[model samples]
Structure formats: structure tokens, C-alpha cells
Target: MRILLVGEYSRLHNSLKEGLEALQHEVTIIGTGDNFKKYPVDYCIFPKYFLQNRILILLNKILFRIFKLDLQLAEKGIRFWLFLPKLKNYDVVQLINSNAIETYPFFSKYLLKKLFNQNKKSFLLVCGEDTPIIDFMLKDQLKYSILTPYLNDSNLKSEYWFSLKYVQKNYRDLFNFISLNVSQLIVSDLDYKIPLPEKILIPNPVNTNKISFDNLVISEKIIIFIGINKSSYIKKGTHFFEKALAIIAQKYSDKIEIISVENIPYNEYINLYNKAHILLDQLYSYDQGYNALEAMAKGKVVFTGAETEFIDYYNLTEKVCINAIPDVDYLVRELSLLIENPEEIIAMGKRARLFIKKEHDYINIAQKYMDVWNRN
Candidate 1:
């Protein structure tokens, strides 16, 4: 199959491309290399004018504050307009998000129309919570979501201005247009599934070949690692994890070592946590995200979302991953339990690696995509 995957955010499409190629399928990816992470792509559409140049970058801030205009958006508009003709003649085209080009609805809708006309089959991936998904989250459909902090705390609402505004009538129109035009809508995780009940559910692909399982050795002192992305700190419930970590650090100062790194590049980020015993991932997801799954593939104990839906899907009573919650007390207790019982940590790490190898191996995920694409 000649598949064209559009947009890259979290190395999701890059890993999927690797899997498809392994299965002898022709796959092409067009993306911005996800900023500093720099994932591979056949076509790079990163708008470089204002963001890369120092003087223009400084001026962009001024433009945003005074005229309420974004230079970065303008760059994307120009680049995507020029790149539209190249986005044709693929057997299948998959969008990373509704606003894959990071432009206004007017432009995105215009582009989607062209995409629909050009491609044989076009699908949308409900990767992150989009406009409609954000609307559903605001309605509290799930037991808990990343939006929980914004809904419960007024102070945190400011941090999510984009999401709140995106769900409004104007922004949602773009998503509506894409939904009507796309051949199918597929979700990579449960967070998107709650809002989109009818959409196909496919687990995110993990490149297990790149990640090797090592039997975690729990020594006298345990190393706990938490990597923070400043953009999604509040949304990912980082404060809750930090508060819980604070108490754990004070209580077991000698037995535990906490490592906190913020907004580093992808390669350095992974290597930074390589020697760690535990990885604390997002607190608001209903399924394991890219980071958690990758850590699990490396045989690390990851504290992430493993809700009932995820548990039931895998059909295992054994706890391969720790369900991270928003409550500080609950998080503290869970960390304490793991700290006290070192042996369980090693056992859980092994189970977590096996789970990733079985459920998220990229080759199997690629076959699932192929099956969906071939279906009438």
C-alpha cells in the first residue's frame, strides 16, 4: 500500500512508518519533525521564517501582543499553500489531527477539501483531544481526564485557553468538516475513544526493536524519574505528581532518588531516564501514552494510566502498570507501596515489557492498520 501519513506530533507516525516499511508497505510521512524531537519525515513542512530567526522571533512576540497576530501561523499558511499539490495520489492518507497544519479553520477546511479530492482514502487520527473531544471532556464523560484540573480549579483554566476556545463554534467547524470528509476516524488511545464512540480504536504503535528489555535490578535505593513538558504541565496533572513526590522524597530520602527533567530533546530525554527504576508518566490518561509504552518496552516500571477499559482489553489480573490518579494522597500511597516492596517493582517491570511486546509491537499494529485500510 502507498500510504501517506500527514503531520507528526509525538513520534507516533514515525514509529508507524517504520512498522509499515517492515511489512513491505510503501509509507510516506509529512510533518514538522515535532519541533525539538526531530522525528523522521519524508516531507518537512516546518514554518521557519519567524521562529528560527532571532530578530523575527523577538518581533513575533510583539506582533502577538499588539496586533494579536501569529507569525508562526502565517508561516504555516504559506508553506501548506505551496505544499498542497504534493499531497496527492496516495492509496491512503492519514491526518495526525484535524488541525494538522496548525492553521485556522478557514485554511484547514480548504486544504481538507483538496485532500479529499486528491487521495483515494483519507482517515483522521483522533490522537490528542481535539475540539469535539475537548467539548466532551468538559462535559465530564470520562471518570477523569486531563481536563479535570481545568474544570476543578479556576486558576488552571487560563493554561487551557486554546482548548477552551477551540471547542467553541468557530474552531469546531473545522473538525466537523474533516469528520464529514474523512473515510474513517481512528483513535490511538481511550481518551479520544470516550468522545468518539463510533470511531475505530487502534493502540499506538511502539517500535520494540529500538527498545530492549533489561531485567530491572532494584537495589537499596530506587530512582524515580519524571519528565515534564511545560506546555502540558497542568493538563498532565504534574502538580499532583510533584506534591506526591515531595512527600515521598522527604519520607524516604535515603531509600529513594527523584529525578525531574523538563522539556529536553527526545534522545537526551530517553537517555536521562535510562538508569531510573521508575518512570512517572501522565496522571490523566485512561491508556498508556507514547512515553509510558516506550518506557515499558525498555523494561521500566511506569506509573501511568491503566484504567478498567485498558485492563479489560488486555485481560490480565496482574498489575503491569500503576494507574496514576490525580489525588496526591493516593499517588503518595502507591509510590510508598512500590518503594517498600522492591521485588514487586522488578516483577512489574518484566510484566510491563512483555505487555508492550505483545500488545504494542509496531509490526502487529501496522497489520491492524492494513486490515482496516483493506476493509470495504
Candidate 2:
């Protein structure tokens, strides 16, 4: 199968591409930059046409009106549409939503579906909450995949500008919203309870192999948090993580080591994970994102709980990490428990690594995608 995967998240590119190739499928991950020399891949540098000035905006409007330019979206909107043919040639197009950028592209996608003629179908893989999914599906029977869906709370300020109109008129429109146009909804956690009729539980695209479980030693006293975005704190309770860690460090004195892998490359970041005892995944988001997976692959205990749905699906109650809310007191108690039972922590650490390897190991993720493509 020729799968044209579109997105810029590092996890999506590394794991999904590697997974697909292992299955002997032609996976071409189209990205925004040309820095893919380290990996065998193709880079599609779509020009950014963000309008900054009124004069240029006016000029672009005139050019668009005269057919001098193709303004399907803002400007790059037209450029993305140029790849509409690529989507047609491929068996599936998993549209990964990065930081809510899917809003701007919907205009191009809607226009292209109308203007372009295609033989094959391309599916939109929403990062869980793309308001436009309701619009595109309702306005024109389109449905997409919800990979790692957020809880059914759309109050956060994404590209939708927090509008309820973005939701379809009724539940009848929701029928198409489930699949938009894809076969199955690729999900990382079974914790999502939004009534997905065609939900396919899959591993999040995490390259667990890159990190080694053998490298984690109990002598390491470091406590680590790897968040790439501060905005994650607002939703995932970054402050809570910080406060909890503060209490542990204060109580343990020099015994507790804490580090935040915010801005760094993979090698440097993984080194911190190697030198750490615990990994703090988000408390706000119910399911762990790629960071937690990475830490787990390193045989580190991730301090976050899976949603009830995910827990029930896996029959998972324990054997790995401790699940807790953002309450500093709860986190402090969990840390104390781990510190007291160092052996248990190590046992859970090993279990966490095995969990990631058996579940989200990039190879299985790729195979899952293939299954989705083949309707299995």
C-alpha cells in the first residue's frame, strides 16, 4: 500500500515511517522542512503564506481574483492542494493535527475535494479534536480518524476560536463524522469514551527501540519531565508536576535529582531519561503522549494514569506506573511510596519498558496502520 502520511510531529514521522517500511509498504511522510538527511525520507517544504501586511494581503487578493495565484487556503493553502493528486494515488493519507494547525488547512481540503478529481480516498487523522471535522463531515459527508482524541471538552482556544457552531447541526451529521472517509479511528488509548463506532486501538507512534531499558539503574536519583511545549502545562498540569517534584526534592534533599527536557535533541534528552528514576507524563491529558512512551521505553516509571476505558481494555490496574491526579499531595505520596519501595519501583520500571515494547513499539504501530488500510 502506498501511504502518504502528512504531519510534523517527531513521533509521527519516526515511528510511523519505520513501522510502515517494516511492513513492506511504501510510506512517504511529507514534512515541512528539508532536515531529513539523517533519515531516508522525502521532505515537502510547503511555503508558508501567512499574511503580515495589509498591502501584501490586498495584492494577494487581486492576484487570486485574476487567477494569477491559487489562493485555495491563505496562500500555502493552494500549495497543499497541489498535492491533492498525491493523496489520490496513495491508499490513505493520515492527516496528523499538530498543535491545532488543522483549522487553516480545512479550507484547502474542502476546496480540493470539490475542485479536484480523485480515484482513491484520503483520510484525515485528527489528533483527537478537529472542529472542522464536524464542518467538513456535515457540509459534505466527510469523516476522519481521531487518533489520541481529547476528552469531549472543546472549550480550549484552538484554531476553531472556541465556537460551538463548528460542531455539526445534529448527531445524524455525527454518523459521517466518525469515519469522515477513513476505515478506522487509530487510537493510542482505549480511554477515549466518546462513542467511537469504528475505533481501532493502536499504539501511539513511539520509537521505543531507540531507548534502552538496560540503561536505567536504580542508583540514579534524577526525576525528569520532558515537555516540549509550555502550553502542555496548562492542559496537562505542568504546575502540578513542578509542585509535586518540589516537595519530593525538599524532603529528599540532595537525594532527589530533577530535570526538565524542554529544549534539546534526542540524544541529549534520552541521556536524561537514562539518568532518571521517574518520568512525569501530563496529569491533565488522560492518556500519555509520546514523552511518556519514550520514558517508559527507557524502563522508567511514568507517573500518569490511563483513562478508565484504556484501563478496562487492557485489564490494566498495576504492574507498571502509579496513576494519580495533579494534586501535589497525591503526587507527593506516590513519590514517597516509590522511594520507600525502591524494588517495587524497579519492578514497575521493567514492566513499563515491556509494556511499551509489546504495545507501542513502532513496528507494531506501522502494522496497525497497515491493518487499518487493509480494513482488518
Candidate 3:
């Protein structure tokens, strides 16, 4: 079957493309390399450096307000319009999100109309914050959510206010348009799945072949790595992790080495943490996000979201992952325990790789997508 995956964020679609191709299915991915992360795609829509460069970006902004035209949007609109003729009669077309093209509502609706008409089947992934997800989160329904940090701190609101406002008003038409047209709504992680209970729950696809597992034997100081994207620090509960790390480092400065890398490129980010004994990932997430999953596949002991629902779903008795919550005291204690027993860290890392192999094997997850697409 021929599959056209629209947009790329979090490298989810890339992994899905790999899995689909491995099963002898034709697949193509169109994306902008997910902004700064620079994940690869078959067809690239990322703009030139002038549009992204600081000085030139300011000039583009000035031009945008004067002419009521955004150069980035203009480029994407033309490119996608020209590409539309080639997109028809696919077995399936999956959108990375409702606003996959990152265009205004009018254009988003136009693109959705064309996509729905062109493809045999259309599906939307509820991976990021969309109208429905935001609406659901506003209700405070979840036991704990990524919004917890933002809700508690007004200072953080400034960073996410534009996104919050968009979902509240500007995005409704496009959201409804896609929801009505798509064959199904699919969610890979519990964060999305919780708010969208009716959507199909498909495990995230991770290409295990791409990640290598090397068990490091620690006789001296154990290295713990944490990478922070400044924009997401508060939302991801990085402060909690940082506080815990501070305490842990102070107590076991001789036995533990804490490495924190900030806002690096995707490949470099992965390479930097490759030698670490433990990887500290997001704390407030309800599931292990793409980064944590990738690390786990590489046999790194990842401290990620292993909430109650996640543990119960897998029937996991052994701690395959260290569940890092939004509590500094809890984090400090867990890190301290692991530092004292280096052998247990090795054991947990081994289990982490096994859990990912069993639950998130790319081919198997891709088969699930095929099953759903074929059925619909």
C-alpha cells in the first residue's frame, strides 16, 4: 500500500515511515525536519536560512506586518499547492496534527479539504496540543498533566499563551474540519490518549535497529545526563530534575557525574548522552515521550514517565523505567538509591531495552497502523 505521511514533529512519522518500508509498503514523508531538531524527511519544506536567521527573520517579520504576508507561509503554500497534484489516490494519508502545515485557519481548511478529497483514507494523530486536547486539559480532568507546571506558575503562561489562545479560538474551524473528514483519530501516548479517549490507542513506533545498546560497566563515578530545551524547561518539569540533581550531586559529588546539555541539535544531543549511565527525561508526562523511548532502546537507564496507568498497562512488576514525577525530594531519593547501587542501574537499563523491544518495536507498531487503515 502507498502511504503519504504529512508533516513531521518528534520524529514519530520518520520512525513510522521506516517501519512501513521495512514491511514492503511504499511510504513518503513530507515535513520541515521538525524545526530545530532537524529530523530527516523525504520531501523537505523547511525554509532557507534567511527565513530562520535572526537578523533576516526580523526583517521578514517587518515585511509580514506591512504587506499582511508571511514569507514562510507563502513558500509553504506554493510548495504544498504544487505538490497536491502528486498526492492523490494514496492508500492512506496521515496528518501529524490538525495544523500540520502551520498555516492560518483558511489555508489549513483548504489543505484539509484537498487532502481529504485526494486520499483514499485520512487520519489525524493527536500527538500535540490541539483544540480538543487543550479544551480537555483546561477542565483539570487528568490526575496530573504537563499543564500542571504552567497552571501553577503564572510566569510560565507568557511562553505558552499564544498557543493557548490559538487553541481557544483561532483553531476551532480547522480542528472541526479535520475531525469530521478524517477516518480516525489516533493517539500513541497516554498524554494525548487521556484527553481523546475515543481515539484509537496505538503504541508509538520506534525503529530499534537505528539505536545501539551498549551496557556501560561503572566502577568509578556514574554519569547522569539531562538535556534541556530552554523553551520547555518549566513545562517539562526540568526545575524539579535540576533541584534533585543539585542535591544528588552535592551528596555524591565523588561518585556521580551530572552532565546537563541545553538546546543542542538532535544528532549532537543524542551523541552527547550516548555515554551516560542515566538519562533524565521529562517528569510531568504521562508516558515515555519519543526522546525517552529512543534512549531506552539504546539500553540507557531513562528516568521518564512510568505513571500508574503505564505500569498497569504493561503489567510491569519490575521497574523497567524509573518514574520521575514532579517532586524534587522523590527525584533526589531515587537518584541517590541508584547511585549507591550501580549494579541495579545496569539491571534496569537491560530491562529498559527489553521493554521497548517488546512493546514499541517499529515493525509491530506499523502493523497496527496497517490493520487500522485496512479495516477503515
> Which candidate number maximizes lDDT?
1
lDDT of 3 by residue, 109-210 (tens): 887788778779999988877888778777777766777766777677887764585465558878888889988999988888878778898988999899
lDDT of 2 by residue, 1-376 (tens): 7776665554556678877787788877655531222223363534444354566667778987897563423444455556556556676666554211222434534633542235344554544444543343323221211211122334443523322333634322332433454445554553332333355556577776566567456674645554444434454566777888778888887666677756455555666667677777766444566667777777788877555545665677575666656578988898888877778777888888877777777887777667676763
Collision count for each candidate, in order? 0, 8, 0
TM-score for each of the candidates: 0.96, 0.73, 0.94
Better of 1 and 3 by lDDT: 1
lDDT by residue (1-376, candidate 1, tens digit) is: 8999988888889889999999999898887777777777787777687779999998999999999888887777667778778878889989998888776678778777887798898888988868878888888867788888888887987799867867877678988888888778899987788688888888999998988778898756899999999888988889899999999999999999889999888889999999998999988888888999999888888889989988887798899899998899999999999999988899999998888888888999999988887882
Off by over 4 Å in 2: 33-41, 45-78, 82-88, 97-106, 111-119, 132-180, 191-198, 226-228, 263-268
Worst 10 residues of 3 by lDDT: 161-170
Cα lDDT of all candidates, in order? 0.86, 0.57, 0.85
Give the candidates in order of TM-score, highest first.
1, 3, 2
Task: State in Å the error of residue 57, model 2.
Answer: 14
The per-residue C-alpha lDDT of model 1 at residue 163 equals 74
Task: After the best TM-score superposition of candidate 1, give how far the Cα of residue 33 lies from its true spot, in angstroms.
Answer: 2.0
* Model 2 TM-score, 2 decimals: 0.73
